[model samples]
Target: MTTAPVIGPEERLPLGAAEADPRTATRRRYLMCEPRYFTVSYSINPWMDPSAPVSTDVALRQWHELKATYERLGHVVETIEPAAGLPDMVFAANSGTVIGGRVLGSRFRAVERAAEADHYRRWFVERGYRDVVMPESINEAEGDFAWTGEVLLAGTGFRTDPGAHAEAQEVLGVPVVSLRLVDPRYYHLDTALMVLTEADPTTGRRAQIAYYRDAFSLGSQRVLRHLFPDAVIASDVDAACLGLNGVSDGYNVVLPREANRLATELTARGYNPVMVDISELRKSGGGPKCCTMELRD
Candidate 1:
């Protein structure tokens, strides 16, 4: 059985932001989910990864428009300082864990990535999230984590380690299902899996994952199987054009403006979708999901 981590109810949205009509607001709120505080990183040359960077210029435009889309959505965006002499810091969103009202900051696996966690910590603390724990023994990255109404699953052997998993589980008083990660380019779980749309207690698996279905070895499959025994596998055509990484809210998805077919399908399904041209950012092997941090879940 996978280790089960119990999650607590998320607190009400922070008080300082200006109030808006919830009815007209584009920001979608999960009934039991809200991200109290969040941070984001910009892109640099990302061609180091072979799978990414097929189209560089188109991806960058989309990355900028992604920022604008979120700003229009009312998420309080916090920017991190550029790491000195880096090719890409866009994946820095995965540096910590928020569980049971406590935020645990972690050490990063990549040497170039270590500074990002500290930046996240300051931002979280400023927002007054209590019970924050600075990780000492292990490295933890967001790619290793998946949240469900019932538990938080953290993976090992990828960017995050088993030591970090155990620490988070104990601090949050929830069972954390730990599994070994598949290696070589599914470096972050987000590359392989992401919840494109999420309701209060349920989440939609985006078609983007189809791009990586053949990559995982054995154990990670067991981890996925444990949770999504009946998950509907998405199709390839839907996966590539869907801007699956750019999903926001349970009802809305942010996508590249060029994805007409997928956008048409989403609108037909009752989603209020938004599109930004991120061709330049994609050149570095990232998509909409790589740029913005979802603050209100």
Candidate 2:
């Protein structure tokens, strides 16, 4: 992968104005759940406020739009039945990470989400995929782990344990780059960084990523700078709105409408910035990426 210098100050653009680049034509399979059981039953992150009222109806509508957008882009959208009591199950990305058809299921740290780990594992196994459930450490699957084509970018210091890094490396048979999550707001690595693509279509190299620098520890920040020097750094306003929690299919980046600055930067990069409003889901500290999980076949 080629590295460029860190981004400098730039002007923001209007939301959803970015043109889609045809070069980014990679289609992926994704898993999602309707927000039928979604609600802020408890506060696990800074974005969640238990006292705040949640509208399940509005949440479902927004989630539907997100699914429609993915389908419009020619990506396969699969469903996992939402259980009655697991409100947070709508955040499908937390279930696990799938690479090379192998699944490493999550072990949620929060008591409320503990049961979800097994449910997700069963779904993968039932589909005939190999599922490995970590027996010892706490790890929230794709929430803290990202695949960069060549290596796995694992996050620690907030939700996932550092010990899982070695385990992930052993299980996946790939090198793991352990990045530390320092900010309370961006608790998960997926919330702080969005993997744009696994490989650049033109260069045939590791694809790019966009991230919030302030969310990582100094050492992790250095690693990001060294590895993805040209990564689009999210502004405070965009980062605060959960803009980095996005899903990309090489050409189009699907993110929140509030992330105008991020949309502008992505537009300038010869890629498409597909914006969607999932404000209702944000009450539970998630956005577009949280609602979807990439399943490699």
Candidate 3:
């Protein structure tokens, strides 16, 4: 994969009137898992260090605050019980990708997180999600797959397998655009990119996004530039803080408090930035988006 080119302020795309207009927040339905058994006892990604100290109590508190943030925004928040010994289960976004009541379950690349897929699949089945499917290929669900209204942007090269991209397209029946990730730090696509405003073909409102350009391969960066010309480009400081690992309901964006620069950029783009401190859970490399899974029913 080719390295991404350095983009300066002068090279940034100019914001148009449509981008400056105030955004509308849509009420959504989401699925979450409490960090009842949260911990970083095993190393999987670059953020995990087994030797580092952890506090389950702190993780629980932070996770609760995140859940409350969603409820406060008028979004329905549903939760699954955190299974014992499944430490990373709290990062529920990996559970699956639910679209129009059809669920595409995850097949985790790590053994430590493998069992999580079944639990999430069962949740959808038990809730009467008739079209739920457990993927045969290895994929990390929403952690590596993001819906942009018109197409699904998928990432591979670290956690999720490249083969899963085609598998998801067949399962969801939506066009999939494969983007290769080059950075290990941003192991999942959601860690390096986020969809800010989904496309609205009726209103001619194009999909808007924000991403860490360096996390993607050069060709992937070009694709992103073509798809979203006015996409927000995150700085190194914001990307390191997992700023791009945020959830946006078109208008209100919930993100980590440490990503100050990203918050400022979102505000300039006419989005309401809601900050939450989940530093305790960050020990395992997760944020708001990581903990929450949007359920499109």
Candidate 4:
């Protein structure tokens, strides 16, 4: 029942020059699924409304633009075939959390997404990933698990079970810091927080992140502040636009176009903000980060 111990404030090091120095972009490999079957046929989250109209064509176009943006920046982008009935398959990040070539597969809380876990696990196995595990506890993979290069920041209370935090730590061999989400709108961890710069022990670079503080419990907020003293705090307006649901390669940050204020703040912090219009996909409570699954190797 116990998870990894949360790092105390006394152990926290000062994050110097997080906003003063220019950020560096590290090339990354990401897995994304085409939105060929993208639609809001069911309501699993607060954002999804079955009564609303959906346009698969718009979703596909927006998805393509996002994929091209990644390639344009020299990041490797891979795709998985979208299943016909699985509309949310376009959100590849929920598939799994891959780190150091090992995959911790997802066990979705909702029955609608339960089948997605198998498909993602199959991809990992087929592509020669040897250490792929399907957890017994309910977890939504990267949807609730975000790697900060030092520890795994796991979320619970909406889509992921707290038990999954310990499971991930045991399987990934990384310390897990559990954060309790308080807002139903920001159900998944990705929606409320993003890693801007991963901790690099070799280079002595501290991890930098951006988050909506109100989305988390008070204790979790304190934990985050201790870990990342220089973390960017997003405003309510930008957070509502899913601004924190972004993909960052240290320097370049890809986020939703509606998050104009956040984009400005990222620029002030020496990070280039690349905005993309994913209004169509947002209907399903997803953004650039949701559609992307980092294949850390």
Candidate 5:
């Protein structure tokens, strides 16, 4: 069997934009590395119904599958240590606005999850990432973050707290749009929304969000009016397939293989949607987006 040669950090996988070319704006590069995104699941997830996490073989296979997809899309997939006790941690990656390859590792809000932060921090700094932002007062989970290039939306009253958002505003130096997450079931803002395309001039396409039902400030239709006027409301199938949980590589979305109808509709509308088997993962309350940590250019 042909094996992939292990390369140095500089030779890490690179995924700029999932679309054919999502970097139309004046980004530093047409392609770049986003190694700060990921996911994790084990037998310990409280959200899982009657089942436990996948088997070690299944878990490792899924991890490798996601890693391969991210690498194919041009991203550096860095595997972190699995925390048997922290089921929500697999998606953990170094959180920060990437400025010249410097990653700002964040402090997690939940004490149970905070212990895992340092693991990623050391990982980033050891790899030569400078300007790391470990906020003294702010604590955030990587899941609380979403990268839109225009705004960094953070959710409070859920896994993330207010202190983290306030500090992130100052630390990240970007507009911190705070939304009160209505319930804890949708752990973070990302649990509901993901940017599938770049900003559109006509309808502000990039501004359009493919989100799901969760406890948040804005009404679904109202959000559509205010944000994406020409938006696609996630169908029931999309919702179940990971309407809000999958990652988009220029509309070739990574969803549950069970969500073929959603994929077909998205494909008809100029998206190239794809799926991965996450039946076991979903039993634990996650899907494609839940599995990815996208660092787009």
Candidate 6:
């Protein structure tokens, strides 16, 4: 069955300056859903090893520990019901991009994940979010779109279309910078780059990023270097363990325990690295960031 694309404007809007000043950044509130039906039933990305055995009990235990860690650090964590037949729904970051209480719902490119758009939309609406902008183009929300400093860093050349970059800018009312992914292993932008400080509230507009340079194209690498000269470049070993697929709160960076080098580098830069074991989820090409979605109000 063919599904008609959600009709919307597709023109690339003019890039604007960063939106919110990071100096006032506060503890971010996030949403996460328990892995009720989490399993790699199909091979979508390079990480999915369906032949390998999966332990739902282990995945649930790890997910709970991660949630507890967030609460322990004094962050508000919200939950949503995981629908059946949507195993990938555990990765809430792909649901949408939230800005100023508005959510630009993701229109997934994969047919297996297509139904996710509406489910997430209803969840937002029921939770009192009125401004939900659905897109016509294929964009994977926070998975392929994230905010760093005042601009939205969008990913393409894999799960997302370059045309969606413009749509996001127009709908989200923030300037978006495009980054192209080269490696199939790092199919999503979140897997290649991690936002460290989105406008450090303590310092000011100063922002930081941790990324794997080789995951991007030559042009994208140049753009990243020009934009963030002091960006933390992850080692090949760390990147292999999905170290770049992490979540940061401007103070604490939550990553997999396998990312030892990244943790050391983060500590050297005066950032606390909280290691968690989400190896079960890693079997599906996701990590800390994939399990959480920041909702900025």
Worst 10 residues of 2 by lDDT: 1-10
TM-score of 1: 0.64
Sequence-dependent TM-score of model 2: 0.90
Between candidates 1 and 2, the one scoring higher on TM-score is: 2
Greater lDDT among 1 and 6 belongs to: 6
For model 1, what is the alpha-carbon lDDT of residue 128? 83
TM-score of each: 0.64, 0.90, 0.93, 0.93, 0.72, 0.90
Evaluate residue 293 in candidate 4 and report its C-alpha lDDT on the 0 to 100 scale. Answer: 99
Per-candidate Cα lDDT values, in order, are 0.50, 0.83, 0.88, 0.89, 0.53, 0.84
- The residue-by-residue lDDT of candidate 4 on 97-183, one tens digit each, is 999888899998889888988998888899999999999999899999999999999999898999999999999999999999999
List of clashing residue pairs for candidate 3: none
- Cα lDDT tens digits, model 6, 216-264, are 9999999999989989999999999999998877656788989999988
- Expressed as tens digits, the lDDT of each residue in 1-297 for candidate 2 is 001111111212223334332334566899998889889989888999989999999999999989988887778899999888899999999988888877788888899999888888888888888555554688888899888888899998889999888888877777899999988999999999988867644666666799999999898899999999878899999999999999877767788988888987877776567888899999999999998889976
lDDT of 6: 0.84
Instruction: Tell how far residue 2 is off in model 5, in angstroms.
Output: 24
* Candidates 2 and 3 compared by TM-score, better number: 3
Model 5, residue 136: distance off in Å is 4.4
Count of backbone collisions within predicted model 6: 4
The deviation in Å at residue 78 for candidate 5 is 3.2
lDDT at 114 for candidate 5?
68
User: Clashes per prediction?
Assistant: 19, 0, 0, 0, 23, 4
